[model samples]
Target: MKKNLLYVTFVNLVNGFAGIAFIPLALKSLGTEGYGLYSIFVILVSYIYFVEMGVAKYFTRTIAQASNVSEEQKIMRSATGMYIRITLLLFIITPILFFIIPKWVFPTNNHGLVSIIVIFASLDYLLSIPPTIKLTYNLGKEEFEHISKFNLISGLSKHLFLIGSVLIFKSVILLIITVLLRRVFDILYAKKFLKSMPKGSWQPQYAKGEFKKIFSQSIVLSMAQLTQITILSIGTFLINRNFTMKEVGIYKATFDLASKVSFFSNSLGMVVFPRFSSVLKRTEEKISLLNKMPLYYKISWLVYSILFLISLVIIPIIPNILNIQDMELFYLLLYGACLNAHANLSYEFLQADARLKEVIIPSIITLLMMSVIFYLTLDYYSFYAIGISWVLSQVFNSMCMDTMVLRKIRKSSSITTICFNLIISIGVIILYLSLGVY
Candidate 1:
């Protein structure tokens, strides 16, 4: 687990650096408007994938279960083959949906060439299977170091690849190609890396029925995933409809920076989830998990809080770095980061227990509510309308998750301390806000 998370965190940091590393270049190359158009392409792609319904995510859990009794090699081979077929089908169908969904999902686009590019980019799902299988093995068994090393190798490779591609090719197509290739390479390497581990016979049998059962579950698991996709792109949908692509661009940059930084907590969560799942309902396991969760929450809170504040420091310099001056955009990012931290702490358990519906139902309701509110309020005021709804959405979702999680772990930890901390934090935040952010 140590290696898995450390490697992931390092690579994530690298990816974060790589993004900022290239932003100045991409800013110069794409210009703000072109960058905004590209952001639209990405947002559309994200929306399409989100509508996919969480199948890819279910592979980890199902494959873990399958691995319990099945031979390791057999599990890997069968899972890998099944993953490939489904990913191919998904990639093939994405373009058709890309063309069709915009009719309903959005009014419209320059998706002509970009649609194909996005579709191609989406195919990374196929290449992700082998590493996923390998990683899940480590996760299920608590051998996180193995997974961590693999990620470190691949993440660095990807970072270099991204940087090199941008410097040399400088096209969105090239960037996508680099990303896809890196994933493909990671899967291949991971598959080979697992060869020396426990040996089980490799069976080539199609096992069509078994694979079908797994796939069915995966589809259900994707609902929570789809909720997230909606959240990520829903902002873009509004910005594009009510404002200009340029507004989308500013929003995209703000969200992207926030999302990338926020990704660290995800790794910590990933390492924790399987361990959490592996625990039994006994007081012992709950005690262990409970002791660990707050520590996890504290680590997440501190990391995100520090990063959030640092982003504040960096925001002023970002205009100089990327040559686009929008302080309010960074403000949006900082707010989003705070929300990201709180929301993640709220939902980490939901993912661990495979209770995405617990996570999804609230998120979906809040999303619909926020969307309606934003749409209504946006007519009078634009971005501020979106921000108000965004903050409320996060607050509602976080509180919901917090209430549920605290209930589950209340016997194990200090609710009073948590409540007091929350109250104090809110007071300080309000004071800071009232003082007027510099």
Candidate 2:
């Protein structure tokens, strides 16, 4: 567990730094409008992968709980077949959606560039399916060291390609092609690693009963994941619809910078999730871990607070560095990120415990509230509308998850932590409002 945590932490740190490094170069090379187009491509590719619908999580839990090697192989075979079908479905459906959705979503943008990006993005995701399934299998097996090593290499190589694409090719089309090729390499690399595992056929082996069982078990998880992705995607969707490509670029860049704070919670959650699933049948052990959740929340809050302070110190200079004009947007989004940092572990625990409705219901409520807030404030606040809605909705969502959902697990201590964090967040908001930045 300690080694896994260390490996995952280092991987996230490297990836985080790479992301931070890429932004400035991308902005310099692509310019704002070009970067906005790249962001659209990235976002669309992520949406395409949503077809997995939490099957990966379901498989991870089942594979982790498997009492024998044969059981594990059975799960892997079923997963491989399911993903193959998903990839084929994507091949058919993605192009049609890409053709229609991009144009509709960004009516004012360049249709030609959109078409190019959509084409490559769809291909990128399709090629990624196999490697993604293999990675999920490794994750279930708690092969964190190998997975992290692969991710480190893959991430470093990807950014190198991305940086090269921008600096050398300076074409969005070439940059996207570079991304597609990276996934091709990832599958080959993943295949080589899979060879070292227990001997079994890696080919697709369709098992209808297994597929139905996994889907039924993970359906609520799928809904929760869909809501989560929609919440993340809606900001980009709204910004693209209402603003210029340049504004979209600025929002995405700032959002990415602010969201780096989440690596702390996300890294910890990833390390703990498999362990949680492995021990799912042990009530006392699970409850003991549940009792420690408040401590986890506190640790997350401390990291968020530290990062928030650091962001304040560096916020002024970021505009000069990134050539962005608005620091207020970063501040608003940072608050949302902080809330996410606090709530992420609790959310993960609920999923690990199969308390899916507790997770999904609050997410649904948050999504509706965020949309309403965006609708009401967009005309008046412009780009700030996205930040405003995100922070406020996150506040409500964090409160719900920490208090209501944690209570379902009989952890009342989390409610106190939630109240304290809420107070701090509210105080920070009031302080930001006093500056009149918005």
Candidate 3:
């Protein structure tokens, strides 16, 4: 396990660095108007995570089970094909439906080629297939290390292009071109994993029944996922709706800088899920190991909180970097790290056992809380309050999810465990806020 974490950790660290550059470059190059269009497009597709219907998470679970039952390849190949077909079918139909967002969502004032540049940037979302194969392999072989590695390479490559484009075209077109190119790379890299797949593995024989089973669960899971994505992105979505695109650009850029802390620390949870599922079946070690989940999560929180705080101080030195104020940007930075870790903690403890059913109770409660808070506050407070409220909701959800998960796995949440969580939580919060307050 330690061996596995080493490689995955390295990959995640690098990818985290790269994603940092990627978001900032997009905001800076595209400017505020470009960011507005991009934000709407991202938010729109988040609604379509419902289209994935939860099959991606489904694949993560079933792939491992299918491997245990018969390693020679079973439902997943056809399942992959089916998943892709459905996603593509939905993608094709997307153009026909109403965009849900207001038509006047984008600012009227824009220079030449704004529509073309922004539209191309949006097109990449359509071409991104459901990622069934990559996910399936990941669960089947516990391939998160590889997953992290590829992501690291791709993420770094993306930053390189982003930095280069800022020097070259220095316009929204550069952002558009970079995004489209990245999609092309995403597909090709995903395809590389496809080569190892069995011949004629993806026949339609296993599609209907199994896909439906996974799809049904995915409906609920997708709601949680979409809500989660919306929470992560809702700030920008609201910013675009209420203000001009340029303002959206600065907000997205600042948020992007905040988001890297999330992407980096997230590797721990990302790698832990499959490992947890594999270990759960061993009744001998089950209690002892399951007890470790919260500890690991808190330990990760402590380490990442400190590291991200340092990064927060390091990045915001440039006053006009994102065209937004440093103080509010700092708040978003803190929220991004803390909320991101908390959000991932829900998935780790709740769904790590492959029981999609677990997410229902907590997700329902969190979803409602988030919706109510956002509704009441968004119109009045704009981006900063939006970030604060969202983080508060995640804190609530993470506590609930952690309480349930600890009790279920450990049978008794010991004093030691309780004390550990208290110390970690209090410390992480204190130090994190100190960075912002200073």
Cα RMSD to the true fold for all candidates: 3.7, 2.2, 4.1
Overall local distance difference test of candidate 1? 0.62
The pairs that clash in candidate 1 are 1-144, 3-148, 4-148, 53-222, 54-222
Per-residue lDDT of candidate 1, residues 1-438 (tens digit): 576678667766776776666655655666555566657556655655543345444544444444444555565565556655666677677767667644554443654655565566456655565566566556655566566667667766877887787678767666777778888789667865443434542333467587677666666567776777777678777777777666776777666655666656667666666655555334687667666655555554455555556655666554466444355555654565576565675565677676666877887887897798798888676676776677667656665666566666655465753564365446545754664544
Please tell me which model should have the higher TM-score, number 1 or number 2: 2
Local accuracy by lDDT, each model: 0.62, 0.79, 0.61
TM-score to true structure, per model? 0.83, 0.93, 0.81
lDDT of 3 at 372: 69
- What digit string (tens of lDDT, one per residue) describes model 3 on residues 402-426? 6666666544554455456556666
lDDT of 3 at 96: 42
Give a tens-digit lDDT track for model 2, residues 33-113. Answer: 888888888888777767777888888888778888888887788888888777777778867886786568656458877
Top candidate (TM-score): 2
